[model samples]
Target: MIEESEKGWLLDNGLVAYALRVGEDGVLEHLHFGGSLGSLAGFSAWPRQAYRSLQIDDRGKPFRHLGTLAQELPFFGRGDFRSPAIAAPGLDELVFESARKIEGGLDLGDLPSARFEGAETLQIRTVSRHMGLEVVLSLTLWPGHPVLARTVTVRNISDRPHLLDRASSLSIDLPQADRHIVHLTGSWAREMHLQRHRIETGRFSFGSCRGTSSAQHPPFIALTDTDTTELHGEVLGGALVYSGNHETVVEKDEFGAVRLQMGLPGGMRWPLAPGEAFIAPQALLLHTDRGLGGMSHGWHDFVRERLLPERREPYRPVYLNTWESAYFEVDEDKVEKLARAAKKLGCEMLVLDDGWFKGRRDDHTSLGDWQADPKRFSRGMGELARRVTAEGLKFGLWFEPEMVSRESDLYREHPDWIIGADRDRPGEGRNQLTLDLSRPEVEAHIESVVASMLREADISYVKWDMNRFVSDLDDAKRAHLYMLALYRIVRKLRKAFPGVVFENCASGGNRFDFGMLCLFDQTWTSDLCDPEGRLDIQSGASHFFPLSALASYIGPSPNHQNGRISSFEARRDVAFFCGSRGFSLSAEELEAHASSVKETAGLYTSTQSLVTKGRFDRLRTGAEIIWQLTSPSGDEVVILYARKRSEPNPPFASVRLRNLEKGSAYRMEGSGELWRAESLMVAGLPMPHTDHRANPPLMKALPTGDMATALLRLRRV
Candidate 1:
């Protein structure tokens, strides 16, 4: 709810509140943002007097105080020396002129934005008449969420076109200067690794110019004080709802005030013709004083409740993907064998990965042609779907609809359909060129092709993959338009096939962001299935996403990507914690461990609720890692993984469980040992000293080995 008080405006959404006041000069100034305060009465006592000293100037230009004060919309070339959220070489002088409340969210043409039933919105309009540009910044607050969704719309009100050198979706002014910035950074195989650093004096920024939301830098940034920890301290997080080229800038001004801005990369000069408008991507901001864990929970709740598709209950199918197993060698007979093996292992879905389309034998061809390969699938995909269904498994297929192979019939027939520069040959990555989704005809063609294939084959799932970065495009606006077009196509497909599940993959996590997650069911976490590497990847990913949004799979031993062999048990344990559990190995090859696979499947079924909808806690002690998942109703499970051999001096390691009811008595599932929650949390569970055990050993003596894994379940009694 938003209310106007005598001193300022108060925006409170049950979980958090943002308070700001219109100063004597009519400039909006940020006052406070954090936990919900229920009412605006507290704002009267806020330190407005302290800012009086900083506002003193003989010239009496109130705008000069913007450097010391918290501004709602600070612009470049203004007296404010801080980094401008919206910078344009054409419009060097811009200032906030007025503000107004809006009843509903502002539409962004074809772009996607967050919306909730009871959300309130406010628009602050800043104008530079000399430069012929007007910027309308919108902020939306939902009633029960701690997040504030923000976006900016730039309008060219003059006779000529305006070019924007920089524009941000949102900018936040933090009160304190001594804070730590936390961001996710890594390469393709190791995406979303958490990295934190103290805020410096100048600008600290990271972004993707790779055309896609590159794996090197995810669209997430956070700020917290030195006192912050996993379970304690205030944390403010911002995640861009864009999957294309994006950037985040963090700056600490001389006045000891920090400002954070996230939006389109600075390299692009977004053009806006007269009477035309350019709406930047949305950015979601979350504030939690309960700590990083609280902030994570806030993000998870928002995604599940507002972003994901509505379902009666969370669904996580036990899948067996044929990508790593069959690769491009899949045929009717081979797929049938895999389906039989999947059914025997209690898998519920069989996803046929790449190489099923026309004229495709390898990654070098047939990406845009959605038709089944006549030579490889002689019986057709419909027949294969039936066969898989006959084995009590649902069928899935893979497609790279947004890309086209230069060697395929689609590109040969319509060369103009691909995005490229005027004279440069379209740059190729993985032997494919990006489809010009910005073109209406190209988007329509892709929609028709993908929809026809799904309708023809009765595909229950679709693995939408984009294997290469976008390039060769001369116009900067095309990149942003391409993402908008992709969102429109996915939205249309979701409405057309409401029952089909979609998994977003872009060369493995390149497009992993809340924007895509809002449309797709889950994301392929990474191409690297090495259990050791996954431990770090999954852990880092869980910081922002819920378990259910992460697609985890066990690949063949001596993992296909990294060639690091791991025990079947270790791989299964790592994959089980993810919302969707699957394997990328042939079912037939797993016959030797059939019983163990069956047992793991059964265990997943029994604990699916705890793993998917539970609160997650990570305990890292040296090389040993313990992940605890606890349901709201008190059922809990923990997976203890040993990444390396145990040391001798300590004799044993201990892990204390979190989020338990201290007074309640709990029983361990396997050993039948019972203990009070308080005792267990205080005394802690111990690690094993040996590698083998007959019966379920106590925490004091768990199996010890390189990549050894153990499971512990608990129920409150």
Candidate 2:
């Protein structure tokens, strides 16, 4: 799929074509990055206009400078004033040297990368014309998707060490295309709320400088046409394959050209020795003209097909966790009871969350000590796991492996093991300190402790939680190294226990990016399990992730996080939208709402596939929020409809469904009425006549309340 074209290089994956050629100045220039052209048309960069411009080439040739031009890897100096993708001291002028077809893909030593199948990899080598620095630009065109995964490795080939300053994963120029930036921004429990603005003359940037990929600004950005929507415009989606500090910048130069770059944060002074290389984390760029829905579908298919590590066991689980229910008070007897209750509730997994470790009466004491609480579980955790598994449920345990409590013995012995220990000690979060996994000893200790727990107990699943952020935001290299270390530990554990379903939760959904998505089986959508809050969080996350990766759960009536009383029915309705659904209600709460709880479990067991793996779309959002999920074969459709307030004699409302086959007839599950797919999508089906009756009153009464919810299921006849 990679061939030498008339112009330069054509890297095509039978679906999308990414063409690049050497400019007149010997630097690589981006030609076209859209649909295939049947055959190469010798497309090249447009003519440059240096009218009233200041930048110039080496020979003082005006209008021939790199500025106002589209470049492959924008250099630091010599012309382009915009931010460069790769930059370092004494390494400014890097010209295109040579390019060769790489075998499979370059192994990014410690950084996480996606597995490529039917991928055409081309390594374009660019070196400084003056300094002896080499930047190997590796680009992989993933099969069957308009996705390009790029990683830049800078090697110091010079005799002396060089200071590496800025290195981004991928950067591309958009020539004269109208682009509007769309991003997700929020805080801890309120994560992934959508935001957007049109790209103006100035630069617009969004990123996470907080050590962990902050929910406030996770590493994802979309450049769309001015009128882009869910199903209707060209969208260029960029998501970083990194869980640490990252940034995305969209710049509009005076020439009407746009440059978008995504990668690690700037201001890094890491040392690059004579022969040493710095491998950046991979970044993905997916292009689709079919709109945001198309972009999401492409990413979803890629993540499922290539990003997630292959597993042996089926993990479509309806689980119950002990967090909101028991918190730090769960004992062996309590866990066994929950396991039995989970089995009776038709749950497949029972996760004993965060209370089994020794000296862990509260969050202040036992995080590093991974031993079972002898006083709570006299027979040990292994026996308890057996007891849970005996009840036809997979046993899952919680572990904050990257954290240690000062009150624990592990920290008492090795207080210097925590991050920022030698320097200024980082302030504690949740009464715990984050272990410096960048150290070999700390990494080994964590790997040993986590693996031991998995082996000690029949842990079919693990709730890996990081409840804090990194201390130093200034050290980009340190954050990068910590991420690399974390990925190493996770990769090893994944290989050792291929069947265990690992779920990543950084105080719930903070680490919910593609990197963690690929590393773990599922991600907690949010710690806020309230009905409306879950809807918003899940909807925003659904913009980038498949429903299968977002773990949606239902808690008690008076939601623990928000203290907003919601019905069990309303909570279950929202949770059913995700692939991984769970319940975190205490025994008293469960007993109070037995019928609705039982109904949810039975329905979830029978129709999980329709909800979990279906194609998802956010139909509408304002007052009434609607979600649509259609089966792959176009036979079944599941729609979740919820409105917060009960309207007073409101106008007739209906939802137009999406993703159904044309000319097909779908039979409503409960109503037994058949409706054509086209008419349903276009004209829409009228919702329940809630709060008011039709002109002629109907016989049945719809569920009317403040937090009203309804589920509609249909199958092709």
Give the candidate number with the greatest lDDT: 2
Residue range 1-717, candidate 2, lDDT tens digits: 787864787778766778777876678878777766544664545445555545665447655777777888887667678988987876668788888897678888877778865677999898885789998899898668888888899998889889888889789998887788889999888999988888898788878776888889999888899998888988888999989888898999886788999988777898888999999889998888888888888888888777776765435678888988899998977888888877887788998898888978888998899999899988988999999999999888898999999989899999989877876667888888888877889999999999998888888889899998877446666678888889989989988998788888998878888888778888887889888888888888887888878787788867777789887778888888777788998977767766777788888887777665678888888778988888888888888878888877767678898878899999877778789999999999667657544622321234677888888788998
Report residue 130 deviation for candidate 1 (angstroms): 4.4
Report, for every candidate in turn, its global Cα lDDT versus the true structure.
0.80, 0.82
Give one digit per residue, the lDDT tens place, for model 1 in 607-669: 777776888877673477778888868856564545555444434556777778878888876
Q: Give the Cα error of residue 470 in candidate 2, in Å.
A: 0.5
lDDT of 2: 0.82
Clash pairs, candidate 1, are 688-701, 688-702
Candidate 1 least-lDDT 10 residues: 49-58
RMSD of each: 2.7, 1.8
Off by over 4 Å in 2: 42-47, 312-314, 695-702
